[model samples]
Target: MKKLVSLLWAVTLLAALALSACSSNQATEALTGGDENLSLDKEFGGFGGGDESPGFGDPELMNDSPEDAQVSDVIADEPAVIDAMSSDSPVKAFFLRITWGLLEGDSSATEVIDWSGSAEVSRGTLLVLRTIRFEGNDFVHLPRDSRQKVEFTSQTKRHFDGLLLAIIDNDTTASDTDATDGTFTFVAGSFSKVLNFSELDSLDLLEPVGDMGNEVSIVTRAKDIVPFAGGFFAGRWVKTRRDGGEFKGRWINSLGTNTGFLRGIWGINRFGNKVFKGKYISANGEFRGLLAGQWTFTRGDRAGVFEGRWVNRQHKTVGRLKGHFRTGRAGDRRGHFEGRYRVTHRENAEGSDS
Candidate 1:
């Protein structure tokens, strides 16, 4: 009886060990088989999984025991099936590769083409191109005639399907069957932003890109010049001093010679361009209308012509006087003053008196 009990216990122990070994092998097979599909999900989303589970009776991947885990038939050094790959859905590295031309073998070769400048698009429509390329390596710059064709063709490409603006080759013409030969270049992996007509006009980006194309061109729209200085004519012969106290006086016709005295304030304009527009007070306390004139200055001497209609206290054109004035006289107070007299008054000078 003691021998029979011991043999039975030994037999039970052997059976338990065999079952445990089978369970362990099954777990190992399950773990390894599921791993390959999981890896595909992380990398390429399982292109060839074909809805089959591991350790199934597919016959090709079936195992004799659970210990025989599923193994990938893929070669370790096989090139990626790019056609089957989702390259169109761009990745960070993909854009980096395209713009920067980083070569892995030959596709990413960095061949620099001449910078053709920039383009603009808006609301999915091509607007204008601001830059023109001169020369490029491994690429032909877009001919002026082919700009429109190239722009239209590029807008349809996979790389620029949704892009608003881009810089591309000029080979796409009506004559060329396959004109998309140039690579789109990018700076820091982004195409330039599109500019509107108003924005472009306001910013003044359109300019003669001087002899050197590398420099930035700035455009400025000009404004109309409104008269800032105009008033009562108080002075005909006015003197301006840099120190202070602007003189305002007028010239009056006298006996024998056209003797006239004047007084008015003289100063430069906002642009520092000389100007003298002020009220002219005659020696007889008669306030003439307004005198407006400009001073064209040179080295040590300055001269200009004064133009204005002289009016008396009754607001009448007593006598018109044309002043061909000059500052810094060589001697006397004579300059050049000539004009027609009023119908009532008569005062005429032969030539000049200094």
Candidate 2:
């Protein structure tokens, strides 16, 4: 009985071994491209053709996929900064011009002004000149067929210059021949700003037109809108009475270069409404500063007036000062300081905005 049992066990063990061998062979066939299991090799072309073995791995596939290829989105930062700098501030429009002279030789007195620049006020440079107000010629004399009779209208006076007038109101259209007899018509109601002229373009007519010379143009430029004193004052302030001689070196603050060589930078300050300030720096660093102290401002009228004292290093009040200030209007230049200031050895008041 024992022998028979042993024989049965031996047969069962051999059968089991055979079955395991078959399973192993099937698995090897699939891995070597024999069995029907889809993989990247079959779908995308590999060296194997069913049950045949290729190399351990496809070198071509491995090389095609780079480890460092980038494929996403990106961002930027300079245009925003540039946009901030180009905007219009209070200081950019702080210049002024006045018209104190009128011409006696032409038709009723009118002034022409013009201004041109970027829609962004800060990008524009100012140019001003004085000229006769443009009125249509004496229309009664010229006939309809005459080219000299082309009608053009007069424009309101621009204080800085007629260029400002022409640009602002398109007044350049008006023209008249010196000796030609005729009348011209113009677009109505263009007159606006005051006018000023330092010299006349032609002497053929009787008088010089525009602001009598007092109506001269003045300009002030800056990157942004700072205070009047801040924009104009610069350098160091030394006492004239001290060993340093008061106005010893250049005094720079905000307004501009405060050297003795500077003429004057005159304009109104919207400082707490509208105020007037002027700087007259001399060789020794002495200057007279004034502010328009009045508050009465009408739409077409002037505003603010200032008066003050300035001393040199010697402790003596050196120069007399005067100027006017106008408010509200875009073309007002009344607060211009014209008088001179003398700088001696003494230091004057500190002109810093602080």
Candidate 3:
């Protein structure tokens, strides 16, 4: 519910903060009002349990060469997407709240791509399925092993990233270490989308890995993903202004801030790292602001007590959000996430560029 997003691109940066992020306009629908369903307790599902992500245990799955990126026999998204926790749990729970229908709407009726997210692992544990000439339901539903066929590929000298190549494209049993443009084919899922980095970048949602052609390992913990509600996330926040004061504001995701300083909409989309970026209407809400932060569990492994921070537009530290939300897997469940913020009133904000 709280997040980012991207496009041809607009990024916010501040010298005092180690974050560069953009806002998304896609999440405006949910921000109109608050949904009471978020009051339920959130569940935290553990990884050392029942769900399985099939990897090569047999000798054939191993790489013949040492340097090649290790591949797995995954029900790849295109081939396999990033490792998905239980679709019903981590994957499904998040998607259930998202407004999926308008994810990639085109102005003209002629459609080129279709995107869908699933709570079931078999369909794809992630969002945004980018493909062309695809007729199957999802990559996971395609041939399990080496039965998937590559339907078409762009003639560019493009190589799939490890996530796209390994998880969504290539199978563990077959490793085309020296995979070429046309020769390499795996019977897992079709990867018809152009492999060009720039083209992939055009897909606003895939910006997380737009900079590189390798696997971008984004390790998201329960703490980070669990607390988010996909809509209005309001909490008591502190500002380091006027000798420090506290205020309550809603954190709008995939869009801009909703209030002034101490509150504003900060757009967050899935990024390359666990870091979350946002823009705030700060400096007393009169000015446009930017904040970059990350989420983590303050206590043990679970999100019993979570923590995060945001650097204000004045290049001052203003947010230290500490709160809790119940973690659950099913989509219908709701969890309450409330916390207090302590402000650090910076008398003289530093850094002209933020």
Candidate 4:
């Protein structure tokens, strides 16, 4: 890590501005005090010049008066780090593995999305991307519902200035075969909620990422993404039975990353994500019809999991569910989940159809 920082400092000094970031504070718990967290703010006072960069810290770090800056100053000085990512030459890249969860209009309905790309950050502008390999309009793991509607081919013009005003075509265009727009909100693991044009445009830009790595990710504001986020994911489910039969399913409302209602499952309880309250209808085919119960599945980006059991509307346990969950931020339930479970039917099962 020290070697990387030295290399970065060496390279940065030559490019435009000379940066002198103080050595990162090593973790107090470690014997060597190696900086496990690598908290940058305390390291360099927000990446500004420190005592190391000659003629750089005159005004800020050294607390030199105006006269000193004038005497030693040769030309106008640039910031220590401008757009830490997304530069024309070599911008920083944060390798994030985001497993997007959901995309409902709600702020909590974030889906599990794996992020594996870089955010080319520069001074004030931030550009993030995850290469989505195209396979007949579908990218890896990005369920059909999560794909954006806009397209970005060579012809499509993607736009971004600084804040979340970036643009994708809004309509599906001749887009690049693969792409994933970063809408980084909250912090590292916890991504922003699913948003649309209106929802996103109204939002403020999220804070920049701290450390850049596999654990890092960013979500683009819904408005900025509309122009180039590209592609579309319609919601539909197909369950293949052990026998030669399959029942098609779809959500009454789009189930996003966090919480949303599910519908049309031949056998199951209510919308079992977070709220875990919805109805289960019985289909006539190979699918056995079942009555409604209390069931929900809430996913967290980094830590929470709404698992355990299926319950009735009265909150009585009817069945059990087991799933794995991860954290997004400090708060539990702010992350996402994936799991499997079964529901128990009452002796006198009353069924209905919607």
**Per-prediction TM-score to the true structure, in the order listed:** 0.21, 0.20, 0.22, 0.20
lDDT string, candidate 1, 54-113, tens digits: 222233212211111111222111243221112232210010001111100122223332
lDDT of 4 by residue, 278-338 (tens): 2222222111222222222232222222333333434444444333332232212122223
Candidate 2 lDDT over residue span 261-338, tens digit each:
222112222232222222333333333332112222222342222334433333355433322233222221112222
Off by over 4 Å in 4: 1-301, 304-306, 314-316, 330-334, 346-354
Error of 4 at 56 (Å): 56
The sequence of per-residue lDDT tens digits that candidate 3 reaches over residues 90-120 is: 4211111111111111123232222332212
Highest TM-score model number: 3
| Residue 34, candidate 4: alpha-carbon lDDT | 40
- Clash count of each predicted structure: 24, 74, 36, 72
Cα RMSD for candidates in order: 45.3, 36.4, 22.6, 28.2
- Candidate 3 yields a Cα-based lDDT of 0.25
Stretches of model 1 off by over 4 angstroms after superposition: 1-250, 254-261, 271-273, 280-283, 298-300, 310-321, 328-354
